[model samples]
Target: MRPSPLLLALPALSTAQQQFPFLDQVKGWFAQASNSISSAIPSAPSPPSVPNPVASGAKVIADAKVQPLTKDNYQDVLKPGAATASPGIEEWMIFVTGGNKTCFGRCERAETAWNESTALLSASRSPPNLGLLDCEAEPVLCNAWAVGPPTIFHFLIPQPLADQSTPATTVRSFGLNRTTVTAPEIASIHLEEKYTQKEPYEGIFHPFDGPLAKAGLAIPVGYAIWGFSLIPSWAFMIGVSFISRSMMSRRMQGGAPAGGAQPAAAPAAGS
Candidate 1:
């Protein structure tokens, strides 16, 4: 039997579809529409790329506005109206670091925050001066500041420069944990409390700096020592006596000298 007429038409249908006569026309229309839409809509320029603040150590340092304080220049900068007062600094916040190896990590960590805070402060309307004091470089200055490694000390200008030591007393300290809040935020908070709120000059930082803290520690230690002292004199002697008796009993039971040989009766007469 002959193949069906529909099967015979299949090849022609395939050839017609393959030609795709309307495809180019459809593409042209779509391209024109796309171009019109694209042209009608305003071209949006790309947003500017913002730099990451803490990108690298060098970058952080570059962005930092901290003044390096050495023995020579520290006094001039930190103290206002001194014989060599820095032109603009009203008061100072110093980042003090020491020579201790253990503090190296802390110092390195705190440095980034310190640098960042200084950068932020630099941008502010009433920026306070920030400085860095390397205790290793200036031992005398660090001793005078009474600061250890990785410490941040805020100093207020004393009314009477005669009270040069007043700033030391009023100086508040930020410890290693200051890195948690870090930079502009932490610096701003401190500034707010110090300047805006006008918190009183407590002249002390950690509780350990206070007499009560010392008393607290001392009381416990003293009590322990006193309790030990109150123990009867004979009580200690009892342990010693008991130990002595035990050793003696052990020796007696062994029935032998430690060397497993008794000393010959002291070389009796010319033996």
Candidate 2:
């Protein structure tokens, strides 16, 4: 193989230059070349340093239009405040799942979309009230609402009648995914009502109102019928036989009188 450039340059160095080792001079030359090459490439304009919009100590989602709601205050915020003469003004609210690994990391995108929707709605002249419930923080409340995590719910709640006695209210949910937001209508239950929201119920067995609940109940009933059908005819016969024998034994025992003596064998005829 041919000698390297460094070896070739070694022989060309003058006697005075050789006094300062050729290797040192070569290194210096390389340093200068590198600087030239770097400068020639137009050192990518250093990205202008940007000031962070939020303070280091600030909370996440501070600017979000979506209000963080809890179990205690959620009802008051979503429901009508006063007993109005006419129907209450319609309101819209969103339930979003976040924190504590609720949806296998899928909630991040969903939550982002929800926040964007809130921002969009807030700009409107008559923006509906939007409240967010974090499934991770308020799991019981989410369960009561029959809300599954990693999901976004946009509910259009029609105001209750002034004289409505029941505290319970039903809200209509619109079909919304990560990005879609639309007006809600009662007649569109088939197209948009993927899941029905059941307000929290304290009573036991109150949650068995869904189709899945019906299936759950039906499963047991089916199992019972199947079990009964499997019972052999001989088993029933055996049970009947045992009961009849018991009754007969009881009757025979009852017939034996309390005297326990034959009186005098009827005072034999010939004796």
TM-score of 2: 0.43
How high is each candidate's TM-score? 0.43, 0.43
lDDT of 1 by residue, 146-190 (tens): 457777666555433465433222456665563464675547745
- lDDT, candidate 1, equals 0.60
lDDT of each: 0.60, 0.53
Clashes of 2: 0
lDDT, model 2, position 152: 45
Off by over 4 Å in 1: 1-53, 56-64, 82-89, 98-102, 158-169, 178-181, 189-191, 194-271
Instruction: List where candidate 2 sits over 4 angstroms from the true fold.
Output: 1-64, 82-87, 156-168, 174-271
The worst-scoring run of ten residues by lDDT in candidate 1 lies at 204-213
